[model samples]
Target: MKSANDQATALLEFRLSAHRTLGPKERDLISHLSWRVEELPARQTFIHDGDKPAHSCLVLAGVVARTQYTAGGQRQILSVHIPGDMPDLQSLHIGRMDHDLETVSATQIAFIPHKDLNHLCAISQTLNATFWRESLIDAALHRAAIFRNAQLDADSRLAHFLCEMHFRHKAVGLVDEEGFSFPLSQELMGEVLGLTIVSINRSSQTLRSLDLIRMQKGHIQVLDVDGLVRFGQFDGTFLHQRFDHETLARAS
Candidate 1:
């Protein structure tokens, strides 16, 4: 039987494996932190707009949505959060939240206090670097979204989003040739793409007809990887893979 310490160590390893540059000391710090596991039901709100956030959450399972509401009560979905993602790290440092984070499925999250995270970073340079990398990736995604909105057509935007999600999922070991389970509905996708549901459905159908992607239930499969890449105009450089020798060379 695995001891409690051993189990905790394994969990930390699993969680931190996505950070290719994380070392043993950082992993040890992560394991030492007490984590509160909470189950978030589908459509439940984790962070509300204008609310002072208390703790930063690390997603363990299921999907979370970061959204914003308009003055007229319209809601826009900004992004979707997956496992191994920390959705509100920016709020922790800023002291106030600008958007809402809600669960789109029955989700599990590990809650870490902001103070605890700060203390951990003070003690571990490796942990600090990991956090910095995560923040940079988040900012890069936002920048990509802004650029896509400016330059891409609705069809191209949808394709790019799907391709980006597929690549990110694969990086975190959550995807295969048949894409990972995406718990988003058409309405949610529409909000993210700034399209109507009718438009999203039409675009999805178009992709299916072209044999680039297939969706069954909640699962998506990239039927033709090369075709999808070409259609999406995707370049994987935005993913910021720390362990990639090419990426390291570029950084240097």
Candidate 2:
């Protein structure tokens, strides 16, 4: 177990980096707000459709899936929440959540109450803009996913997902050039890609044959990053250009 001081230091560092674009006063307000860290077991539901969100969740570790069920009882995965992502940003303006947020593995999350968050944002214009910027970026990612799903073939879809994950992992400082830790099961991946587990497995083999990617013991390694990007037909603009030029300039 980590000591209180260690955890405090970790949270401080995370806050500094996450909101680096904010001014010193804005950062101080964020630090003054109380944040509770909670651990959730695999398969646990954090938020469900029609539920009023009480707090915003920041994924600290492990994967979470945002899924929606059709009238026919089939589930469609909207997005997978990883570390450094705010899974409940929609709650800021929306009164109730429209999808289910559930953990794929034992996960740790930091909960920031909506009321306190509103107060913090109200006090800091920078934080308010930052919050909305993140929301817009999330919307763009959803749009990209929709387009990819509609246009890309199954093999290409799998490749695109891998490339997207690689970049996201890199954004959070979790990826090396080869790849990063990918712990999701094939079935979960299938849900996200709208593919059968068998199809996903077949595509995985195809990628391996192409010498583009390799997976073992839940860790994925991109053997040829350039080749994988070409196979996926990936455009990094969607992932990398999340922040505005001014915000990035300030952060730098």
Candidate 3:
């Protein structure tokens, strides 16, 4: 279980700065955040479609999936949320949910009431700007994902996704000597990337053959970062991470 301090640390990583410490004002807002923590088992749904939630979920551990379903119940994973991400932050203004939010793994979340957030924003202009900036960043990420799927082929698409995930994990200090942890299964990947499972396997093979990545169990080990970047035509600029691209591409 993550402690309150651990939760604070995660919140601090939310697109604030790369390695720099937070200023006094930022720290004050973080200290004022009120949340009730909950631990969820893998694949559990946190927020369902059409529900008007009173609280927004902050992911403290594991991944969250934003999913949509067809009339026939065919599900498509719209996007994924990592630690330090509030997948439903838009819900503070948007009253009803348009899709489902589910845990991709055994996840820990901090639920901050809408009332508390509203009060904080009303009191602090800085806090309001911060939240607004976060929402804009979220929109940017969605645009990036759309570009990836619409333009890239299967191999390049998968490569681009891997590269994005790597930097996102690195942004939150999740990357280590072995590479960043990836808990999503290939099926889930296919759903997120709009590829078939067979295409996912073939793409993985192509990447491995090119000596760009090595996967053992669930974690992905990026090898030859330069080659991987070239193969993917990946640009981290859209992610708007505080860290430099070169710094994030290199494994520790």
Candidate 4:
């Protein structure tokens, strides 16, 4: 079992990423949530499609991918979730899972039972609303991903994904002067962006050749922030970030 301090730190990260602020009561409620931690290896599929999950999975470490497979066995990645994300929170309301949730890297996750979450929401309106807002944001991100896949060229699509991850990692205090850890490999990037491996390679090469980004040793460093943003056609407004666009831009 992880110590209380570790759990508290994880909850704080979630609050910081989910909302700008939390009342003492809300924080207290979150602290009281009971969870069991699990360490799983990379490429592991813990939650299968159509499973009625009893707990919501909070990412304590590494990234999680929400994916679905077509009848012909082609995979489409719906979203990439990072630390502090309660990726299965929607399971509290929506009983059955529509897609599989898998780890992209060796991952540590805290599983909070649905019974506890339902009870907590029963008493706290603000906390309930906060969670509801988070689910809405999740939906918005999916829509954005769909738009990018349908409308943007391969290079621009990849650029947009890079910018989005940079902003999100920055918000959660995961970014540094050298940039943040991006766990997605080129093959995985192909899965997420709905492109072939060859196309993904071409797009990645294009971005690097243009001096917009550097991806080395599983980390991305933004060399030209403005150029990347313009190329990606990225706008942080839809992210519903607590910080303004300028703050996120400057941080990158």
Candidate 5:
């Protein structure tokens, strides 16, 4: 059985894994986050659209996506989150979820009560800023998605997402120039990229055959980084990873 201590420690990791590092006082607050660990199977919904959540779930392991559905029954994945991401961080103030947060892989989550966080934020400005920054980053991705989905071609959109995820993973030391773990299926990729599954498959093969990426055992090995970046037309500014490069290195 996982103890609360383990859960809190994982929360600390999640807090520290951000692009910006918290101060000592903020780190101390993370120790008092008051979290409970929960293991969930893949494809399980942690929170659904329009649901009110009293707590926020922090990913300790595995991946999740916030998904929204269109009136036509098409699903659009809003964001993909790795360990250390708080998919429903906005629910603290909003109270109700606007989208469904679902696991993409077998996941371990630390549920932290919003009441505790709200109280802590009232007292700790650093904690408040940290959480605020996270929300801003989330908004940045959404903004980027709107542009990328609207303007870019299917392959370019996928490329941009790869670059974006690479920097995000690097901030938390989950990836480097070689590659990163890619647990998403082609179908899921299609949903997120607004492409058909066949198009997604073909685009992936195109990138591979072009020697831009090599798919290793469940990992995407980026072979030609420059070419991939050019193909994707990626600009890392939207990711906000430049906030603290030294902090990212230290966290990694």
Candidate 6:
């Protein structure tokens, strides 16, 4: 458990947020940030699309995603954000959220108001750059999501999604050989892959049958990384987290 002031997880998120490592000076910015943690249940919208928010929400634990709904009320999940992520950082400039941000798992979030965040950024050059880098990664992930929906087949989409989650979990020291947490539901997976829930289930079964993956007890383990990479056409270049390579090197 962390203190009420939220220093530890806040710093953890910023450090894993960008490709660059945080130095002592940069780490000092954590002491300046003001936040309060919120424990939200799954499927609850913390940031509704079209509403201007005063604070930005950071994911300290559990998963969250940016979602948008079609006119017919079908939801589309744009990106899955792991712990060490501030999914709504863009609201600082955009004001109103263009998409809804909701918890995919029971989540612990820290809300830092824009004014406090801006003050910290203005005073520290490194902190400013780190935040900007995170926002850029956010855009890149959204672009990849759009391309995946427009170009990829069903199997490829799910594979890419699993690979993305794997790398993201790896980023923040959250992986084990058995696999990391997978709190997402089949319905949420369908929204991400642009498939029906049944289709997503079928795709997972196919992947398992082919010895590419095993999903059980809300965790997914890759049985064959090479097979999964080939099947998903997952380049992993789009995530732009170059430090992920360094992290893998350390783990190895």
Q: Which of the numbered candidates is closest to the native, going by highest lDDT?
A: 4
RMSD of each: 4.8, 4.0, 3.4, 3.4, 2.7, 2.8
**For each candidate, what TM-score against the reference?**
0.89, 0.88, 0.91, 0.92, 0.89, 0.91
Q: Give a tens-digit lDDT track for model 6, residues 104-142.
A: 889888888899888878987877887888889888887
Q: Give per-residue CA lDDT, model 1, range 8-97, as digits (tens).
A: 344445544546646777766777877778877999997888888778877877899899988898788888888767889887688888
Which prediction has more favorable lDDT, 2 or 3? 3
| True-structure lDDT of candidate 1 | 0.77
Model 2, residue 225: C-alpha shift (Å): 1.4
Query: lDDT (CA) for every model shown?
Result: 0.77, 0.77, 0.81, 0.82, 0.78, 0.79
Estimate the TM-score for candidate 3.
0.91
Error of 5 at 137 (Å): 0.5
Candidate maximizing TM-score: 4
Candidate 2 per-residue C-alpha lDDT over 62-126 given as tens digits, one digit per residue, 9 for 90 to 100: 88889999999988889987876887889978979999999988988888789987987788777
Better of 1 and 2 by TM-score: 1
lDDT of 5 by residue, 45-148 (tens): 87999899999877877889999999999998889998767888899999878899999989888887888888878988777877888888889998988888
Candidate 3: stretches off by over 4 Å: 13-22, 244-252
Q: Which segments of candidate 5 are over 4 A away from where they belong?
A: 1-21, 176-178, 243-252
Per-residue lDDT value at 244 in model 6: 58
**How many Å off is the CA of 207 in candidate 3?**
0.4
